[model samples]
Target: MTSRESALIDALRMIATHPAARGLADDAAVLPVEAGGLVLTHDMLVEGVHFLPDDPADSVAWKLVAVNMSDLAAKGAMPLGVLTGHGLGRDRDWDSLFVEGLADALRIFNVPLLGGDTVAMPAGAPVTLGLTAIGRAPECGAPSRSGAKAGDDLWVSGPLGDAGAGLAIRQGRMDGGLASLVTAYQRPQPNLPLGQALASLVSAMADVSDGLLIDARRIAEASGCGVAVQMDAVPLSDALMMVRPDSWETRIEATTAGDDYVLLFTAAPDRRQAIEAASSRHGGNARRIGCCTADRGFALSWRGGAVPLPARLGFEHG
Candidate 1:
């Protein structure tokens, strides 16, 4: 399951299989259009849940856009535009800053603002923002979480755990001296180009929105296979290492920590060269972390021994 929230989605899925929903197996809804299919996704961010009150409004806006874009990237779709839903707050200056951040994200990602609605909420209500992202898929079917096969090599686009480190900084648990960690948590870079390149090449793909363990399990469950993640192969950014020491425990936390929007995909061993070339072309430091197995769940291993699964896979809501 992609989320523990799947119980509600499962109930909705019982009645919501519109063919265009793709059985609700993939991240975005695909609607067959004239030239190709249109990929559509909507995501919401609450004030305290997704961002802190003291965090920059612009960064919050940027994160809202980036997170949605990350979903599109998973489907190997090129973003067309976005429609925003904004909850107006009492602080007009904060709202203005959010607009600036939103504008910056739009310009940076080359996605346009198609338009949306805004509402004035109660005085102290938390600000909630949502975005509906629309994209166009290629002639080939959009890559899906259910596409991974046994014997497929699993790969991740870049480093993990940096955002978790950044989150700690924002919470004042650590000094904000490490700019990379702070920036990673606040503004994430989705591998759009790599996604485009691997559209037809990879067997399955997803952006690591939740922790890597949970997200990888999503593909495994959707594909009806098992996934074995090599703990040592999980890459950690130098920035993260600078703040946290090098150890297996640190690696596990990095693997399970959320907010790193890196692309995780599976490809046949034969496609290694092409995958490497694509990553190089896109400025991504791709790593082969593990492989899909014929079994039914996740297995973690390092230094010739298996590691116990963590009690918690990732962030889960009550």
Candidate 2:
């Protein structure tokens, strides 16, 4: 194994001292929690791949929470705590300020910091963020990507493509609200409450990390069903709306771009009203984007017409 892998495993082992992270599993880890199995998920963010080196500390920290929590929110898991693995600089002050940003995010998410490790990268090629988040299942159940069923109502917590917009502006791809797109990229408010409320309601659920079109396909395949999303129904923020509405390419940008951190869920028509009411109570924005069909085809409807899946799909690693 590489040294980096060894160090990561060792550090994770220490945090396992808690009731949650104990005796980690290699391929996958399972922790016995109080209420059913609290789904466990961890994502490692590399400086360039996940965030730019020039990104602000506060923004970076917020992105960490947004990404890790996205997993739990999709699983209908309640926030428990997060284990942070820090890679710091030789200068102590630089590292301390980073901690402050991370602390700020934890406060916002109401998620505790279980524990983590600290290490210095001599060359500092790219600092990595390792976050392990644990969340309990809802009282009624946990939502799974594989649970989607035919005739289910497909929905997303909010509009799509803000994070992609944020990245575009940052990379000079296009000029727009740095703040608005940034919020979609950073400080993502995981639809935790909505997920919990829909735990028993949603036939299937997943977070929109990789464009709606792509992630929706995942649910469809996993659940052995076909999905049809209405392009006009996909929500958009005032920030993303500024991206040249006349241009179909730009519109596709937001649609295919991922990292919105909203929940993509499917439910029975019978439960739509109840789900909407619950969402209002949770203070989450949700809307019906499409529907699931028994036929095995993934499609999108635009301007009252149906079309094949966009070739863009979503984020692809590698």
Which window of 10 residues has the lowest lDDT sum in candidate 1? Answer: 3-12
For candidate 2, report its TM-score. 0.86
What is the TM-score of each predicted model, taking all chains together? 0.88, 0.86
Please write out the lDDT profile of model 2 over residues 185-299, one tens digit for every residue.
7567787777778788889998888788888999999999999888878878877777657345665777778878888999999998998898889888789989999998988
State each model's CA lDDT, in order. Answer: 0.84, 0.76
Over the full model, what C-alpha lDDT does candidate 1 score relative to the true structure? 0.84
